[model samples]
Target: MENNFKMVAKTLFGFEELLAKELKQLGAQAVTIGVRHVSFVGDKGFMYKANLGLRTAIKILKPIAKFKVINENDLYNKVNAIPWENYLKSDGSLAVGATLNGDTFTHSQYVSLKTKDAIVDRFRDQTGERPNVDLRFPDLKIDIHIDRHFCTVSLDSSGESLHKRGYKIATNIAPINEVLAAGLIMLSGWDGQSDFMDPMCGSGTVLIEAAMIACNIPPNLMRNEFGFERWGDWDVDLFEKIEESLLSKTRDFHHKIMGFDKSPSAVEKATQNVENAKLEDFIYIKHEDFFKTQKGGEEHLHMVFNPPYGERLDIEMETFYSSIGSTLKHKYPGTNAWMISSNLEALKHVGLRPSRKIKLFNAKLEARFSKYEMYAGTKKTHKLEAKND
Candidate 1:
């Protein structure tokens, strides 16, 4: 137990509970949810596993020190007091990034500069050399958080945001974030038991994420690097063992996973990305207007998509939303459709009451994720008319 240390996995808004559940399911101990993060205790190997396995996590941070500071000078002193030599060599490169949530720190950039100066000064004074700042690639990536007078310094274990997943080589206009896509799929409660689809697949992010979840695949297996790989005490054998352990748990996915887009360019890009992820066998992308399509099978279908919202004129968007409602209501029976949109007014034109609506964010814009359940037989028409009324 002594070997276990507290780590925080940062996530997007409205995803704290989902990320917490993911960590707990991954065998984390003492899991607790924070505003946009989940803190837990895990050993170094678990850290590697979390980075590879957690579909909802943005980045994992290991807290190195926490202290109280009233002024900038106090911040410099406390940061300088940390044993940076143990984490980085004098010749190594480093980067410091900060987030401030209180009055004491007015500018996050200024805070990052102060922290970087302290570390560089310490190394220069003790070893006659200092690590240079490298934002793109660093030997050690440090994170600083200042809440009022409380300060926490942490080491970033995942080099890039986990959303990069390294599977996407091409992107279309306004492609969905991979982390958000995975979280949305999880929230929708799709488990590979039924056929899955993303009608407006764009670059096929959702379809890929759904297949990964269904197959129990590690999300970051395709990633080229992690922050821990460059740490001073990096252990190659331990990391490889953790990776193999996660890979061994991957299971077979039998159901169909498909995507559709009106644009031929989008279909091409999506196909390329699916091949890059080596999931082409499990995923199929087709160029077709989703509005013109019907359910291909009699079995229940689970759908999640991000439709165009407000990009066109108001009248056009309203018609588009209404067509979506009409298509699902009349054509796609025995299906459950979920969509996320920032256009609340356009969503109203859909003409069917959402059985469930959850507030979320698409980047900086406040959005809504809603669900529509279409049943089989005559009940479908009756329920659709009732919701419309």
Candidate 2:
């Protein structure tokens, strides 16, 4: 218990709660939620597990110190005074990133530069050799977050963002981010007990993430590297054991997972991504427009998709969105259809009041994840009645 330390898992906007839940389920203690962030207590082995397992998190930061600073010099001195040697060798490479949210610190780049100079200078003064700055492959990645007058110095434990799950080698126009896609699926509350789908499954990100969730596969199992791999106290054997334990929990998913896209190129790219993730047997992709498709069989269905938002003028945004509603209501029954779009006004054209509307950020654009329930036959016809009324 003494070895357990506080760590912050950063996530996309509106995914903090999902990340917190994931951490708690993964055995994280003292779980606390913040804006786009979750704080928890875990030991070294647990840290590796979190990195390997957490799907909603963007990065994991291990805080080393926290203090209030009035100016940039105070920040530099505070950062330099820390024992960098413990984390980075004199000959190793390093990178520093800073985020500013106060009037005093106007430029984030300048703050990062100052912090870098201090650390390199300390190494030069002591060992006559300073660590080189290697932004691409740093021995230690440092994070400086300044909120108001408060500054927190931390070590970035998840390098290159957790979204780079190492399975996506192909992408199409508007292919959704892996982390955002996973969070959306989790938020939609689709357990593996039912048939799952992503109608417009460009690059198969959502479909792959869905299969992983259904079978309890760690999101980052295909990732080439995790930030903790470079830590001074990395334990390879423990990480292997953790990996084995996580993989051991995998279960069979009996429901069908399907995908469709109007573009044949998109279908090809998505199929390639599916194969890359080694989930080809679990997912099926076809080149078909979502609006022209229909649900079959007596199975209940759960769907999550990102149709073209017309952000770059592919089609009439309103008409396209309306088509989404018409397709779901008339074709897909006994199903819960969820879609996300930054075009809120166009979403109004869907004409079906959402059962759940959640605010989420797709990259920098603010979007809404809204759900429309399609009942079997005239059953639960209230949605259509409400639409007509």
At residue 158, candidate 2 shows an lDDT of 85
lDDT of each: 0.93, 0.91
| Candidate 2: tens digits of C-alpha lDDT, residues 32-70 | 999989999999889899999999999999999999998
Worst 10 residues of 1 by lDDT: 308-317
Q: Considering every candidate listed, which one attains the maximal lDDT?
A: 1
TM-scores of all candidate predictions against the true structure:
0.96, 0.96
Q: Candidate 1 on 1-389: residue-level lDDT in tens?
A: 88999999999998999999999999999999999899999999999999999999999999999999999999999999999998999999999899998887889989999999999999999989999999999999999988899999999999889999999999987888999999999989898899999999999999999999999999999999999999977789999999898889999988999999999999999999999999998998999998899997799999999998775424488889999999998889989999999999989999988899999988888999999988877776867987999
Query: If candidate 2 were superposed on the true structure by all CA atoms, what would the RMSD be?
Result: 2.9
Highest TM-score, which number?
Answer: 2
